[model samples]
Target: MSRRRQLHMFDNTTESELHEQTFTDAVPTSQRYLHRRGETYYFKRKIPTDVPHAFGSKGETHWQSLKTNSLQEALRRLPAEIEAFDSKVRKARESRRQGKVPVASRPRTEGTTKYLQEAHIPSIIERFEYSLLQTDMEERRVMEDDAELDIRLADFEQGLKLKKRAAAREEFSHVEDVAQVLLEDERLIAPPGSAARTLLLRELMRADIQTLQKQCDALRGNLFALPPTVPVAPRDLPTMQTAFEAWRQSQDKDRTIDAYGRYVRQFESENRELPMASISLETANKFRDYLHGCDLDRESIINCVGGLATLWDFYERKSNRITSNPFREVQYDGLPRRESSVDRRRFEVSELAILFNSPVYLGQHKLKGQVKESAYWAPLLGPFVGARIEEIAQLRIADILRINGVWCIRIENLEHDQRTKNMGSHRLVPMHKEVIQCGFLSYVAKQKLAGQTHVFPSQRNTNKYRLWSNALTKWFGSYMNRIGLEDPRLVYHSFRFTFKRQCTVCGISDEVRDALTGHWLSRNSSNVYTSDADRQYPFPAVARGIKKLRYDELDLRHLHVADPFDQVDRAWKY
Candidate 1:
């Protein structure tokens, strides 16, 4: 028996497992519902038992050949095929319930009329023109005479005249088959004899007549005869998937692309994947409202809208056809006003005291996979240096160095796959005296002596994004939750806010604080256009600001270790 026949013979359990393996293991997740037979792929799905008769299928499953062997091409064509299948199933179910024929039908709405007139008819005319061009090219390749072309043009004219006459007499029998083929090709299921079908048939007949007239005029030696003027072709409005792929290619950072791509995918899921041109201002507003209704925070909604706006702007600039971005100037009510300072919730001094007195800082906690030296030192460094978690987690032993006779930790994207948030993030931050006194230097020395490349070599950077801090961030969240610090805004990032608050309290200059934290200088600030040498804060001056960062209420005397190598060595063995 054939492999396809054998597949049908398998029991439910085995069939499901095989289906999972075939789709999941052999292809990417986005390409599900695809089944490969020999070399060509087919879109296959099991027909619901209730709707099997509606689909007119004898077997338990139904499938259609994708008609392409190239995986990339198949992927490109898959979305439309999937949409058509879904539309078919939906219409079939509706018809079965109504006890009507299994044909697609919809109440003629204003939006449907607008789409048919502005998008669908123009698309049909363009396709007809392309097919005509293809036939002409084939005839020219065979050296066919103009007499044959003239005869074909005459036949088209006669067909158009007959169609017009039949339509005038309310007899659309001649055009029904042609209209049905066009409707099916566009995946619009107008019932066999419904008024909607009749309207579509009459419109197609009109387009056909106009096109035939143009052809006859061209054949009569008017080589510059203008084709029928329909609305702009729907082909000009690219699919959402196509636009995203183009936009994604223009991006520089993988993380930015991935972050923004997520919002795009979410938008596509919430709103149907529509062509860029079809996304009107109303559509944009509805999408924003939908996101708001989903209980997403205002900031998250802003990001989603902002990301799509950026993408829309990119596509507008690239295409030069999209007149305006729908997502532009979309408003969200009840959004909080922006704050100048870091907006994250800061850890209270008492909370800091509790965290420092925890078992990990007291050296009583057991070392596991994620709860390693990084976890212990990273939190300690956060308040002192104010570096991002990923920046600190990805640190190397070589990053610890003496600059201008002051011990400084360099945060840079120089080696070992280190990545800073941006160019401004690359800077020299003097090690705080508190960090030094807490045996941070001793830990670095031990890592160097042990010939380890990364300070937190035990923390795995195994995520797809290769972020060393992913696992550590999750563990920190759980740790905070366990320690009774269960506020939504109180996160690992809160350390950065606390550090900034301390900088203000310590009377640190804006330039020094910005330099240390790797924040961008304000465009209107005097230091924005300063020379590189003038902008670079001396390590001693930075160290002074760093030393001023003191928590009078929080003491960490117990965390100071005279020798950490032995303790770290013992922990490493675990």
Candidate 2:
């Protein structure tokens, strides 16, 4: 045969024969999803029409470079890639159907009657709302299914003999499958669905309930396809401060709101009266640079940016009020994190002696004008028990109780008037004998006799969020300055470190020390298990540790008064 005639015959080969030749040359026949191009594997699939519109693709086929030269690794990743593509297609189709968008063009116009008429399309916002409602309904159905499963499981656990345990196990596996399919928590592995795994799944679901709801909304809006700069506006939009108020209201405590106020204020001050919708990457960068210009450290800048991002994110994900977050993923470009420059010093033994010997301890100088029992005991207790000034200041009379035959103060968040840092901060701090010897219990009895709930009644609640934290912290700082230990960071918090050091000097175990100091227990299964349990710290161990505490070098013997009732010996006067 002539050479030209042979080439023409090869080009005219049947499609099946051509595919077979390509497969034999590049990929194994067993690997259905993997295709090889130039010795590298690629994920090749036909682009679904609906999915292509969502991604703005006009191509007939999509080829993703797996960036792997190994056939084995490509095979390993094939299933996940296919699953991801399927999910994308599904989401895109749902969005298009809900929005009634034409399959040909993906347009970006505000959802208005005029706009829709001109564009010949459904209102995108209206579509999103409808999609949200539909998703809400679907989520309710899934939640109902999960709830029914929970009820059945609870009945099984409670010894109700209606159904077999095997049925329950089967139901659990089914529910897990449904979750894996719907929720797409591919990272979770619940094989055969043991009780521990069930517990873990339940915890994960609880934590991600809001997030899952937000994802459903985002999918409905086709948010993944939207550009980062595109502003998403809901029908009813709130002002910047109004949005911030809504965000703050959703928080667990008012303290978080108060802490975030500084960032909000900074944004408003730097940028003149800008609306929440007006905030963009440019504005956010300006604010970051402003913070850096003010000589704020990297963490502070991170916190400011992070706080704003969190606020904006809450609105976007929770309320669906906005589309973009300017502060999200913002980087601190050239700013280096300065080592904490605060010159905090632990109270020296001599300094404690000097303070205790001064009128503040000796009852020679009486506390004046809203200065309460905290001034007296907090200073004295600082050297002994090593508690935060605010913790001591906010203590109720009931907190000081005898637990396990030892007098201790319970630092808890039970009272409406108190707040704790974390679970670790809520603990039983054993009251030193020196505290009782200095008429502390006598003062509590007096306050109780007067029908006072707070251990210190003289200090007013200047700020509602923090129970005299600002005022008392300032007072303590001034008192320290007066006594001549005037380091800026050596204010009230230094006592905590001093106490920690003293505990170390006394050879306290780390677990015991953490219990006393309100530090999280060892970062291990023990800590996680303990946190999950009803009781936080091991009480018996904590009690033993507390009993082991002794400030031997600390001598406040002169400060101790003989009579609890004597006017000359009244520590409350100071």
Candidate 3:
């Protein structure tokens, strides 16, 4: 009752209670169907029992709780609820009216049933008897026609069964039962010489035939009731190969096009060139399964399916060749998570010793008498510079030069015989001191002196992709095997791992390493800032970062090879 006590009580009041009090202070009570309980508003309306059956659970009142305590909130909610209720009531009434058949639409049936029983059945029976007695040839012809109709009816019934049309099945079975009952009537089951028996049998048989005819007609109507199909023209739709070519024409990456071509070719080789219309989701899955069966690695399988999906997506939107991308929904069994890190291991000093001490590394192998060509130098260069196998093998003499007083291997796709993986792959990787000490620049100078265009002329481009070092990749595999390095993953490319590992050990910034290796470094903010031309690190600074890397713990000074040009000269008389 005291002022302080009243203020204390007001302080304890909830927001909703305060809101409700403010609303009710203006109006004591709400309109019909709107009521307050606690601090919230509610809408209540009774559904009359006399309403149409579609309304469902009539005579029960419908209630909706308007969550807000404010009067304005309740007012905002009321109109929408009222409109919905009105719509339900209108729909229920409309549905009730639809249930009743219009008198005008009903056919005149006063004499039709009676006429069918008395006259129509007799006429059909007479015709059937006359036709049966005509000839053996005529009987056979009629039987064949009946068999054909029965086959069509069976197909329709089976389709309905597959659709799970239980009501239709029950209705059809009821008609059959009625036909059977008519056939089993006492007049139709009499002994021979009874004219009544013959008449009943013929009449019932005619009725059964008519029943079957009506059922067939109804089923046929239902079967063909689908919306009219747009006729597809015989527009010389492209095969899978042709479609692939069309898609490839739009792609900008030459390597991507070549890789896509491999997948498409392999698909065609196995499945034959499928017309775009015939290439479906099922076929895509089948190809995936086939790839799995062929024992292709997980990455290969993913690439195959992804390539197909990409092509299908291209055609699905750009041209009217395909209805949909069949491979869109295909789930790729992603690369094995644990296998990723384990796939390549950084070369241990011991492993590096084994690799560099091999006959090929010593320049004693068959290729160009180990002219420090791809075979001799690629392995040595990959570990020092972290270049890809192909990149090292396909290097032209022009690619090796001094940048700001430091020798650099300039990676780029400047000729048909050379290609970098991507734009980021074009970079300048400075020569490591160990490589320079081992006479790499000396090898380059010698190749240049001999007027060689490519630094490694022994590695040739025999493929359509202009992958000059593809054969070198296989040779490296064989050499690795010969050296007793049994791991499937520790091929020539593992040298990249060794180089990157040494870089990390030397505390090289990732941006510097990425720049040297031609890896996309945009994901790193520092790399992005560093790459900006105005504030970019100078070429000499980058060269210093490259020079900072060293592997002195394991000595590779024993890998000195004899001149490779001399070996090539002795191999043939040319």
lDDT of 3 at 275: 53
User: Per-residue alpha-carbon lDDT of model 1 for 226-331, expressed as tens digits?
Assistant: 2465334443446555556679997656777876766765566555456665678898898787665544556667777888888877776787764677788788
Q: How far does residue 358 in candidate 1 sit from its true spot (Å)?
A: 2.3
| Candidate 1 CA-lDDT value | 0.69
State which candidate has the highest lDDT. Answer: 1
Against the true structure, what is each candidate's TM-score?
0.65, 0.53, 0.50
| Residue-level lDDT tens digits of model 3 in 94-194 | 53332210112123221122211222334334333333233322433365465665776796466445434433342333333433344342122233334
Over 198-231, each residue of candidate 2 has an lDDT whose tens digit, in order, gives 5434433332333334444443442322233322
lDDT of 1 at 357: 89
Which candidate, 1 or 2, would have the higher lDDT against the true structure?
A: 1
Better of 2 and 3 by TM-score: 2
Candidate 2 global TM-score = 0.53
Model 3 pairs whose backbones collide: 370-564, 371-564
What C-alpha lDDT do the candidate models reach, one value each? Answer: 0.69, 0.60, 0.61
